[model samples]
Target: MNDAEVLMNPNDLVQFLKKNPEYFTKDDILRFCEENHVEMVNFRYAGGDGKLKTLNFAVSSKEQLDTILSEGERVDGSKLFSFIEADSSDLYVIPRYGTAFMDPFAEAKTLNILCSYYDGNGHPLASSPEHILRQAEASFKKHTGMEFKCLGELEYYIISKEETFYHRSNRIGYHESGPFCRFCEMRTEAMLMIARAGGKIKYGHAEAGSFTKDGYYYEQHEIEFLLTSPILAVEQILIAKWILRRLSVKYEVEVSFAPKIAIDRSGSGLHIHLLAEKNGTNVLIKEGKLSDTAKRMIVGILDISDAATGFGNTVPTSYLRLVPNQNAPTYICWGEQNRSVVVRVPLGWVDGVDMAADANFGLKRRSEKATRQTLEFRVADGSACIYEMIACLICGAIHGLGMNGALTKADELYASRNIFNEECTSFLKTLRRLPISCTESADALISKRKLLERDDIFPPGVIDDQAAKLRAYNDSCLSERLRRDETLFTECAEQYLHIN
Candidate 1:
């Protein structure tokens, strides 16, 4: 472990302390541990073999760091999933101070800290989910001379695992609460867990198919929740799923982040919002037109759009939700206020334009603080690797900015028509289509090695391994021969614990 204290800037630390004020004194942590009857903190790390290997950390006084350091632990890194392979299965997890959060579900104040994983010989695991993001951040800063901040709105489902198929009676539309009216209590617990985990709570509520035919019954039972950024958002999704699953266990049901439950309705999407700052100025916001920098960002995403789709929606069935006619982005295009388009410059006031474009759009000069701008990239889904996906996006933006790729001269770039509207068909015709299956996506990844290989953005072996695994699975199952596999159908039911 590095001897230096974690050096977050004063402003960043203040931001953290502000959102999460439930700081625990060392005594508070030990006392809570004693009272809760909690014995150890579990640490999990990926081995080179790509399997999870877990260890436990004992609770002790702050001074125990030296003692704990003396009491070493060992695990085979080659068996871990994240690392490629390890001649030595040696890996250790050293907890960082100050990350402790009381587990709300524990009877006692059970504290947990995010652990750092290192190889037996003491090398940082490059494949750890967090490590991937850190690398992406480095690339982002180097290429764009800006720091990237991200936020997301996660949409998913919480349902009874018992009822596999709902016996349709009278058609109900959105928000028609019933057995599905499982929100109120779960929302309370979810908020508590998030707050305890040091995350600011954003509101959550029912989205489509509460009780209407428009609800699209079987497939569309879902909910939407928002989080401040990638780390917290992924954490919330995992925690929420766990909480909901336990609650469902009480009711004997299940929950999942799976993008598709059935066909013809919206699949869950992890829609991301990105902003870049250089020396405290919002790089993407200027005059009327998006900054050439922002445009470059968009171009990078558009260029390698296909290669990144593997993580955006991991499952083979994710493609069903990405059809051209459906809500998902089927092509690479950006327009103002368009959903069918992959990138959308959200509608805003004339003052919202970036300063770089202000002269062109003819806006009066205003303080940067008065500026508000947002860009939406809509390809991601629940199954994504939060770290990898965000890293790829940041890199893409950097690439775009470097190439001045946003210089594409479309006549009506600012048009605000609905992306799914009739006009989009013609405009979108020039764009590429999302792969219809996971195999297709994997294939694209294998085929486009050069594009992703630049900057060593995506490690080559990662893509190859993923593709080979998918191919082997498909080959074994003979999935192509079956129009729809019963196992896949059952897996969907299993995912949500809809047991009927």
Candidate 2:
């Protein structure tokens, strides 16, 4: 789209607003077109597999939007990592009308649109992640009349572009604060862009990753932010990463969402906060009883832990952050405040302070009734496929709720602490660790859980292809002997489980 083709037409925009009053306003639409340097604006509806089944001009004076609508946008479908046949890579990126928004970062009146991949004839691409998530969500609702809400905390590290390899390599402990938290200015700029793009964020602040008073890194602090829904959170996460990457490039700093950077430093985690609603009430919390539905949902989560990990913590680097004794779970268990538990059902809303303080010893306590209660899952990382992971978790929970599985609590787990410890030891002896290389994970995924068989999240050959790419990624990392890996096998690390 050349510069001349992107201008907005007042008449078309006024008409567009009349049709979608909530989405577009004449002034907002005009500002969006003028600010983003967009060349054209169009809308499309695609099938479940991300195939564009239909495309039409929504509003555009620029020839670029019209050109793509008429001529189509081409992409190498084979390179999409989750699809088959790189040679049949020719695909189209059809812009979705409902997804259109202003890109605050672009110099021109650039409009942001969500797109789906499709064949030359506009057939939906099978196994598209977005489509798969929609299917999973629908299936879950069909089985259990329940909806899942998810919020993800993305934790990462930012380093100065000029920092030496030695400094980055060193385990700086809990002292890497102040100047070490590079790109504050850029982060603020990125936040503004994100806000303009409709990213509803609760707050953004410095995490514990800030260097300590003594100049060491305190890895435990997470940059927590609130989000409205799982889907929105996923979009915001990707955009945040994208924006951060751009900021890094501009500032000459390195940014990483990897789990572990050093042996002793705190590793990153993507802790997801989840809740459910039914009949306009909080199902996860009602009249003080943990709803039968909520308990069953927990069972489903435990059941699909293994399969979920492939997407939840997809990167090999994620394991580096899963070490033992890091107050992270390495076992499949739940406790009131036990950091070792994979799932923690905190007390009700009223007694939060006391419960949290007393439960600090890993004890379970009830709280005053509040409707905004939730459950926290502690084993995910930033590398996850947001759509896939959330869907899988929701489905598992739905399965549990539908089946009415046994709900295990913190006190019960501790009562059998010794037996559980012995079982953990025995299980460790027999259980295989996930692949440490991206290639290996991809390979294991191919041979063990072929993508096609697993609800078609990725195409038939996509897993294998992704695995190959992962293998290349692993080889590029420092050798295992000399590399600084997180303490994954230790006592305090968080463990992801698989349902057999």
Candidate 3:
């Protein structure tokens, strides 16, 4: 801990210090503390609100550090969640060694790792978000003999401290480098930090949304991660959010994930692409068309999109982002290459073309046909309870697989063309719609609670708590009121600008 001991740079990956970067046992983590002259150990985990919580321990000696890491620490559940009773609030937070990382901005040499909650009987707490996701995966694999994998398209806006010379038009700042995108450098550094913290990233880029707000400039950016298991994806996303918020402090700016930043500005969405795997191979694509299991998942998501909004769209103004023609889905439908529907089947090398051969001469190789097929659900946004949101989706998929008439429902909800177009107005009227208010979302969840409670993966307390909180907003009529009042609209939007 001396000043003369050279400090490790933040961009340096801590996994390099291990024999295997992907494996981190207790002995390996303990050896890291001893060999690297570590001074502090931090235990981080997700709480009821889906925010990362931390409890720090200063390593007085190797013995003290060992005990802290092995035995874990106790926490008050009542203070962290609304559903937990105050009388029985004691719970344990145990560290997950695989998530260890070097704290980038730490003044002291510190090692940070994520943790999981455990009950008094030394079992994972059923109400824990981490446990619920793990259970869902196991149940899904047991029932359908398939694994659930997801890819998240994380979107956010970076508000610079002052205005820049480049005047980005509303919803037109997609992929401009150097001068136009002022926050490109900051966004890239965040990507590196996320990578160093064990995130599998695909790419980062500018998005098609920008606006000046509250005397500051705001430009949109997105960082997409590669496909991973549902549990791993959720953890990576929470870590990414933590790193971005911390990095924003150094640059003296604000980073927000609110669904609707303004009335007409392009809202940020947490779009997720879901893939199904069986026997170590992707089963999502069959014979160059949508597979049966994949179709069921799409229909399942469409069936529960309205109810699932309780977990995704948390705030009152989130309803504003789901309006028609705003690049957000408003109806219960699926489509291929159409953005107007809730579930979209993107171009996934369906035609069997070797896309990489033309770009690289030496890399002229064909695909194994085991990957690249995905069904993207675009209903959720940034203010989501990520653990429950994903769990709900997986349950719906399982239910869809077992339900009758899935093929019929899928065909009925398929939209070949944009349903909002002038020619398809009558067709759009026939389809069902998403919830437009907090109250409506709560009512949908209340009615469809059995869907989520089927496998016991989703705790009843969590479901009840979520419904109660959503109903408490009483904002079912707020959207109608805000339409005629601009002053009140801005005031409501400002409160949630940095809520995530």
Candidates in order: C-alpha RMSD to true structure: 7.5, 9.4, 4.0
Report how far off residue 213 is in candidate 1 (Å): 13
Per-residue lDDT of candidate 1, residues 232-285 (tens digit): 444444444545555655544445566666544456777777777788666776
| lDDT assessment of candidate 3 | 0.84
lDDT of each candidate versus the true structure: 0.56, 0.54, 0.84
Ranking by TM-score: 3, 1, 2
Indicate the residue-level lDDT of 119 in model 3.
85
Each model's total of backbone clashes: 38, 59, 0
Best candidate according to lDDT: 3
The Cα error of candidate 2 at residue 414, in Å, is 7.5
Q: Between prediction 1 and prediction 2, which has the larger lDDT?
A: 1
TM-score of 1: 0.75
Task: Give the winner by TM-score: 1 or 3.
Answer: 3
Tens digits of per-residue lDDT, candidate 3, 136-232, equal 8888899998889997889998877556476664548889796888889989999988887778898999998877766777788999999998977
lDDT of 1: 0.56
Instruction: Please identify which of the two predictions, 1 or 3, would achieve the higher lDDT against the true structure.
Output: 3
Off by over 4 Å in 1: 1-39, 44-54, 58-73, 161-180, 211-252, 347-372, 409-420, 447-457, 473-500
